[model samples]
Target: MGPDDAFWEDGEWVSWDEIHQQIQYKEWRAKWPNADLSLVPVFEDLISVAEDYFLATGRHLQVYGDIGELYAAITYGIRLHKNFAQGSDGRLGNDHIEVKTIAPMNTKDQTSVKLSGHFNKLLVVNISEEFEISSRMIDRASLPKTSGNILKIRWDDLA
Candidate 1:
């Protein structure tokens, strides 16, 4: 209905978690009453707040909210977390998400077999890339292995 509305409707969205600083849990709760905070507006408000916080403090904030709620928000380019969700899926739709299990392992190098999951026919991306994997993380699941750390994961399983 307005120029700004039109701009948003057609605009490309950047992930909120990628750019925001930590949110004060108490402040966030005070501002967003449950059942009333729509995804886009919340994300926009958080980004704006984060920008200011970063300018004044020179640091990014980690937001605290239900992971499921946050996951649902980022699909439209907004995300809230103390740490950005590490993964390539973007948490949008099955087309870009997947669930995998590690293969069994012995005491050799390390190998894994991706079990089942859903993802867009496009390439699967790793979310953990943003986080540091500990050296002590020694197990089949410590790291995921696809043909090249990514592939076109199956899509029906997510449902």
Candidate 2:
């Protein structure tokens, strides 16, 4: 696992890439029984838009990134709950989740994991230069104390 793929799981660091790969493998097995989906395209248009937005604006667009988060939630069978506040990105089972995405290549600051309101869980999604994606799911209680609206945890802590 790369440094960027590290995430705390069961009190130990694990590779989000490996977890996601396992999920995908199980999904494929359940969906197609024995057939392979190697040629299937997943979020081609959205990924193109994300890449274009980053290239043109020199920053990661929130809407495009949110779309990626939504895709991840769906893939993992999480239900989305939209609201203006309260950090309601989606829900995994009974846990209220807040999804945050960052493209490491687009920003120099590694302390961008900001949060407001309340959430049971935080999902930090990291997108690499090659558009490879990984995520870290952290319980809000495990996070450090917040100052004002920002959570104490940063990108460096997760990445």
After superposition, candidate 2 runs with Cα above 4 Å error: 1-42, 52-62, 83-85, 109-116
Per-residue C-alpha lDDT of model 1 across residues 62-147, encoded as one tens digit per residue: 53122223433433332222344434223333334322221111122222323343323222111222221111111224233555
lDDT of 2 at 48: 68
TM-score of 1: 0.27
Question: How much is the lDDT of residue 9 in candidate 2?
Answer: 71
Q: Give the C-alpha miss distance for residue 141 in model 1, angstroms.
A: 23
Per-candidate clash tally: 13, 0
Off by over 4 Å in 1: 1-37, 63-117, 121-147, 150-159
Looking at model 1, residue 55 earns an lDDT score of 70
- For model 2, residues 40-106, the per-residue Cα lDDT tens digits are 2344456667778878898765564555465555455556565555556777778877777765464
Worst 10 residues of 1 by lDDT: 129-138
